[model samples]
Target: MRGETRTVWPAARRVAGGLALLGAATVGYGVYERDAYTLTRREVPILAPGAAPLRLLHLSDLHVTPGQTRKFDWLGELGRLVPDLVAMTGDVLSHQDSSAPLRRALAPLYAFPGVFIPGNNDYYVPKPRSPHHYFKRHPGGPHKGPALDWDGFAKDLVADSGWRDMTHVHDVLTIGGRRLDVRGVDDARSRRDRVALVAGPPEPGADVVLGLSHTPEPRVLDAFTADGVQLTLSGHTHGGQIRLPFVGALVTNCGLDPSRARGLSRWSAAGPDGAQRMSWLHVSAGLGTSPYAPIRLGCRPEATLLTLVPAR
Candidate 1:
């Protein structure tokens, strides 16, 4: 009996130690992944000329709720990056009344010039879910309410942040005689894209042209390319949000190939006269999960840092 008791004690001690180590590892990984695990990527021969490289920061699909302290802290810390300009694509709030919290969450970005567009999630979605999925998951999946006040939210966002309301519009950024034209459309999920806004290229002498949309639909992509836009930045699919190591993305919402689901992709353009050109396309993975679906598995949220260099 004494001998058996000694052997059992040693095994139990080993099992306890193993459990403790596993718990520590899990906690450590959560912390590491929670902080901005930024992946740096680039495209050389970026089509700009004779100017110092301009740094453009891109963030999207925030879905910020009422009390996301971590997200606010992260945005505030972004002031350390000192980017020349910052742009957000859409879905700023998880719900319409969340505008107050969204404003507070975005206060840090006020230090720099910024632009924003609205996603389908913003305009008609309820507290926990967007209207985009209303019919798909009927019979009561997660959401338990009606739509929201989109007009009031839109007015407040424009008034508070002074953001460029690029819903079917364009704006230009100038530095040392070179120009970067930016054009955007509303959410493709809501089918509000006005392709005409992206049909005309800025007049000659524009150094770079960028297109913005909430989703990466191919029709809009082709239109932007047709307009002589050199780049397009978008965020919607969450980069599959829970990518597997070997299998890659489980799903991609748009025509974007699974390989180009979250990061930079290259697109070729045909000139109005029929000559071919090339450009870069970057898609941010996004910051927060939909309120109805909280918890990201593999893909951590990201803000992209795009350094646009002159063609060599």
Candidate 2:
């Protein structure tokens, strides 16, 4: 009996030690993943026939905090890509004091045309919460935090940058010789999106109609698709921030399906003729995490370069 007990005790200790090591390794990996900035490039064929290809840089969910020099340096270098257009879906700042650094980081990209919309984090500051909250749908209610001065942030960003504020408004721009009818909404997570303000068919003679929003809510995507918007871009899901192998994103945090939380997918809506119309959807995994939950797993912080080629 004594010999058996000693063997069992050793086996138990080994099992416990192994679990402890695994937990430590996981936490370490999460920390490493936070700073693992990656650039993802994808070729999307969505242009009209005979139109020249356009290079688009999709940036989102920066959640910038002061003193993240590495991230700022990385962002400052993105202009070297020389994208024809830049689309920033929000959460640019996590703290009110982060605006200066955020602007500095984005300064290089000002040379190109860009457009932006605000996310929940942009309007409200982030408060520390359990990381587990990300894995589940946010309980519906008002988020608690000090409000941010989004207007000032927008003003600063647009001062030298050609980026347009597309929240609750529609505008047309000529880029790469194509007339882009761009429409956007403010963050829907906070119920700030006034979709009706910009809801309608694309302006006649526009080459392409695109929709932008911070959260990839199904209702917004539906409205955009119904109005002939051929493509939509969004962020806010963070690709579940911590994904699992094989299973992928654990939660989208919005109406979007978990499978479509990141990367490009197809959204279909019934057209005026009752025919099914499909729109291309691109949801960026995004570039930064909330300062409180400063970790990532399986999903790396990313900025995407989308080459909009002529459809075959």
Give TM per candidate. 0.79, 0.96
| lDDT by residue for model 2 (1-312), tens | 999999999999999999999999998999899889999999888888888778889999999989999899999889999998999999888987988888888899999999999998897788877756766676554455888899998988888686899999898888866789999999987789888898888888897788999999888888889889988999999988889898999888888899998999999988777888889999999989888878889999999999888888
Number of backbone-clashing residue pairs for each candidate, in the order shown: 0, 0
- lDDT (Cα, tens digit) per residue for candidate 1, span 1-312: 999999999999999999999988765764555444453545435764676777777888887767777787777777677766687888776765678877776777776667777776776554555545522312234442456665677677778877677788887866445676889999886678997865686757777788898887777887788777778888887777657788777665666676777888888767687888666778888887676666555788888778888778
Quote the RMSD, in angstroms, for model 2: 1.4
For candidate 1, the per-residue lDDT at 233 reads 85
In model 1, the clashing pairs are none
Model 2 weakest 10-residue run by lDDT: 135-144
Q: lDDT for each of the candidates?
A: 0.73, 0.89
Q: How large is the C-alpha RMSD of every model relative to the true structure? A: 5.7, 1.4
Candidate 1 lDDT at 310 equals 78
